[model samples]
Target: SQKIEQNSEALNIQEGKTATLTCNYTNYSPAYLQWYRQDPGRGPVFLLLIRENEKEKRKERLKVTFDTTLKQSLFHITASQPADSATYLCAFNDYKLSFGAGTTVTVRA
Candidate 1:
């Protein structure tokens, strides 16, 4: 079966700095990649999506990069603030969206 993995550990960072997250995949080549932010109890809210051929995509302070050659993706949040803290998920399009475990981020004032 295919698998997508993100660091389960919570990341802590100071305010005004960038927060980076990583997603690794195996056993499949997806058509596109999507990112979302989830609160502790709520469902994930879509952020950005990048195609297999797209090297990078951005929206405001959020940036996403996909590398089919490396079978990995990188997600970045610039000038992070306390409000930016949340669990970030990486999903792939394979007739449907398959999600990773999600990585939590925390920003301190």
Candidate 2:
């Protein structure tokens, strides 16, 4: 069985600082990993996708690094803002896809 875990805490920080969150797992085969952002009751919106062969991925102010050897992924947001406040999720794709419960992030101005 595969399990995905992300910080369940609400990350609060001042605007303009970079926020870093984590995604970890156990018993997962390397295939594909994706990051998404969700606001309130909304569905997750895709942020970045990294493959087993890929080392890292980036988009706009977001960045994702994958370490299959470590069985972990790191997500970073630079120049974060109040508008960036939301829940972040990570998913693992294999025979079936599994997603973390998500971590709430609050950026104060």
**TM-score, structure 1 vs. true:** 0.97
Task: Report the lDDT tens digits of candidate 2 across residue range 46-98.
Answer: 88999999988989999999998899999999999899999999998767658
Question: Can you give the TM-score per candidate against the true fold?
Answer: 0.97, 0.94
Tens-place lDDT per residue, model 1, 45-71, is: 999999999999999999999999999
lDDT of each: 0.94, 0.89
* Candidate 1: 10-residue stretch with minimal lDDT: 92-101
For model 1, the superposed segments whose C-alpha errors exceed 4 Å read none
How many pairs of residues collide in each model?
0, 0
